[model samples]
Target: MRCFVTGAAGFIGSNLVDRLLAAGHEVVGYDNFSTGQRSFLEGAGRSAGFTLVEGDLLNPDVLRPAVAGCDIVFHLAANADVRFGTHHPFKDIEQNLIATFNVLEAMRAHGIKKIAFSSTGSVYGEAAVIPTPEDAPFPIQTSLYGNSKVAAEGLISSYCEGFGFQGFIFRFVSILGERYTHGHVFDFYNKLRNDPSSLEVLGNGKQRKSYLYVQDCIDAILIAVERADAKINIFNLGQNEYCEVNQSIGWICDRLGVSPKLSYTGGERGWIGDNPLIFLDCSRIRALGWTPKLSIRDGVVNTLEYLMANPWVLDARG
Candidate 1:
């Protein structure tokens, strides 16, 4: 199969590109290097089956033609800056919501009937349910990032219903593994590297969150795309277990062999749209015989190890 993946140079996208190539599929990777790293694509560049296109999704003239003659579209590009969504109000809509519209329109123009989107668990927004299910009712959106994803999910489902398209929507918890550039793990590691004696944590450090390794995330995506045949298939991709923010800190500190003085700004949530707890019920995907190989602790340690080995990622991100 010929696969077209957006955000192809990103952490998860680059990893997925390598996997698809290994599975004997031809892949065309589309990316704008705004937050994507070229170094991440070194492995993909070696593959004869992989083609890289440099363009932004907001430009349909570029995106539409680039998407031509593709079997499936994996729309993974988006503004995932949830913590700073309020600072730049229009960033989420233009980068996420409008960009998704463009991708859908491009797919429609090119006769592409199948799409897999990277949605987020943030869309749940402080749910009343603990382990939120795929069918759980969405509460008020707490962040602009989540709001945009919610809108994008609706658009994808509508396209499936109105245009005979097959859509796979995976709402993921925080992903951790190699090529992890952003998120709490990256932030904490970067700060600690600079100042090993002190570490300032956000909130009260009790935020319980579930995470999935990058490979495990891609596994669920491929499985769902292959087996699930609904017009709009929605699955929550996450570990069944979760860990507290403080517990994860212990793991990171233990691995780094540094005990920094911990100080916290007294609050229940980290940021404006931060949910205090995020534990998704992934039984739907688990029923497909897919399970994450790494626990939250393992994932965190692996991510830190990657950062330590490749300090350039920290310098580049900074």
Candidate 2:
């Protein structure tokens, strides 16, 4: 099988690329290096089945060829910086929604039948249902990033129904593993390293959310793409449980041996688009014989350990 993966140099994208190549599939990786690291693809680059392309998703010319002749496309390219969505209002629209438009158009043109997109739990936007299912009614989106994902998901579904494409939309919680670059774990680790005396938290130390390990995340994607048969399949890929922000901070602090005074700035959420609480009901994907093996505590601890061992990622993220 031939796979074209956007954002293939990113944390999850790179891991997915490695997984695909190891499974004897030819992989064409597309990335712009805006946030994705080149070193992340070191192993993928060495694989004979892997081909790396340097390009941005916003440009159709760059995207069209990458999509050509690929059996499947894993669309993971997007502006993942949800915390600062307001800083550049159109970044998410351009990078996520518009980029998805380009992928769909290209896939349609080339007759590519399958696409697996990386959606987010944020699209649920303070969902009314605790442990929100994939079919849960979506409320008003809280963040621009989440809204962009919602738009992308709709486009994929429309394309699937209208153009006969198979779509796998996986709404992910926070993912942790090696090459984990951003999010709460990264923030907490960087803070203690900079100042061990105090750790400044974003929310009121009560923001709780579900998480999945990157490997398990990839497993859910593969499982859905392989086992599930549907014109449009949407799965909430996450752990069976969730952890609070304060709890995660405690775990990170314990691993780092730092007793930093915690300081939280916001009330219910940390930022404009922040969702105070999120826990996805992942039974939809689990029904297809997929369950997360990593616990939230182990994921957090290993994330800290990876960042600790690879201190270069912090500087590289700059």
Candidate 3:
């Protein structure tokens, strides 16, 4: 199969590219290098079956050409700066929502019917249900990034129903692993690197959330895309278990061997629109013979190892 992955140079996208290549699929990567790093694609660039399209999806000229002649589209590119959603309000709409609309339109024009969209658990908006399922009702949206993803998912569902497209919507928790440039793990690592004596944590450090290893995330995506045949397939991709922010901080500190003095930023939530807790019920995907293999602590430890090995990522990403 010919696969086109947007945000192809990103952490998860790059990992997925390698998996697809190993599976003997021809892959085309589309990335603008805004948040994604070129270093992530260093290995994929060497594959004869991999082609890189350097352009932004906001531009139809570039988006249309990049998605052309693709069998399946893995739409993962988006502005993931959820914490600073209010600082730049319209970025989420343009980069995430509008880009998705453009992709759907391009797919419609080119007769591509299958798309695997990278949505998020943030869309649940402080969901009342713990271990939230795919069919869980949505509460109020907590952040602009979550709001945009909700709109994107709706658009994809509409496209599937109206245009005979097959949609695979994956609501993922935070992902951690190699090439992880952003998120709490990266933030903590950078902080400890500068001041090993003490670490300041966001929120009360009690915000519990689930996380998945990048490989497990891609595994669920592949299983759903290849096996699930529903017109609109929605799956929650995450570990069955969850953990508190402070708990994860402890594991990270242990690995770094820094017992930093812990200071609270004084809030139940980390930032505006940040859900203090997110425990996804991944049974929907687990039924499809998929299960996360990494614990929260293991994922954190692995991510720390990656950051330690690549000390330059912090400066390069920031």
Candidate 4:
């Protein structure tokens, strides 16, 4: 199968690209390097079946050509930062909502039928249930980033109904693993590496969320695309276990061999529009014969090891 993956230079997108290439599929990678790293895609480009297109999803000309001749489109490009949306709300809307419009238009023009969208767990917005299901009500988003994702999901569903395309929406939880650029774990590790004595957490260290390894996320995408028979299939992609912020901080400290003083900025939500507790019920996806392989502690240790070896976190700070 020929696949066109947006944000293909990003952590999860690049990982998926590698998996597809390994499985003997031709992959055209589309990325503008907005938040994605070039090194991630460069490593995958070494493979014979991978092609990289330097382009933005906001531009129809770029998207149309990049998506041409692709059997499946994995739309992962977006303004993924939660805090950034607080300061620059329009940035999220433009990158996520407007960019998705361009992708849909391009797909419609080219008659591309299948799209595996990278939605967010933020769309659930402080779920009343511990493990929120796909049927859970989507409240009005607290952050513009979440709202933009909700809008994008709606657009994809509209396209699926109106244009006869298959749309797979995977609302992802906290994703941590190789090639990760930003997140709570990365922030915690960087703080400890710089000042091991005092660690400044963004919020009160009580916020709880589910963490999923990048491999598991990619696996869910593959499973959804292969088995989805619905016109619009939505799945919550996350680990079954939930980890508190302080617990995750302790895990990082233990892995780094540092006993740091923990400080907090005071609040349940780490940042504006940040959901305090996010635990997704992934039984919907698990019922499809896919389950997360790495536990929370295992995933954190693996990420810490990767950070130590690659030194991307140090470079990211500098």
Q: Each prediction's Cα lDDT score?
A: 0.94, 0.91, 0.92, 0.88
Q: For candidate 3, write residues 1-318 as lDDT tens digits.
A: 999999999999999999999999999999999988898888888899999999999899988978889999999999999999899999999999999999999899899999999999999989999878888898988799999999999999999989999999999999999989899999999999989998888889999999999998999999999889899999998997899998999899888777889999998988899898899888889889997888888999999999999998999987
Off by over 4 Å in 4: none
Whole-model lDDT, model 4: 0.88
Model 1: pairs clashing at backbone N, Cα or C within 3 Å: none
lDDT of 1 by residue, 29-63 (tens): 99999999999999989999999999999999999
Question: Looking at model 1, which ten-residue stretch has the lowest summed lDDT?
Answer: 287-296
Provide the lowest-lDDT 10-residue window in model 3: 250-259
Which candidate, 2 or 3, would have the higher lDDT against the true structure?
A: 3
Off by over 4 Å in 1: none
- Candidate 2 vs candidate 4: the TM-score winner is 2
lDDT, candidate 3, at 165: 97
Our tally of clashes for model 4 stands at: 0
Over 160-213, each residue of candidate 4 has an lDDT whose tens digit, in order, gives 999999999999997889887778777787777778999998889999878899
Please give each candidate's TM-score: 0.99, 0.99, 0.99, 0.97
State candidate 2's TM-score.
0.99
The number of clashing residue pairs in each candidate reads: 0, 0, 3, 0
RMSD of 4: 1.2
Model 1 C-alpha lDDT versus the unseen true structure = 0.94
RMSD of each: 0.6, 0.8, 0.7, 1.2
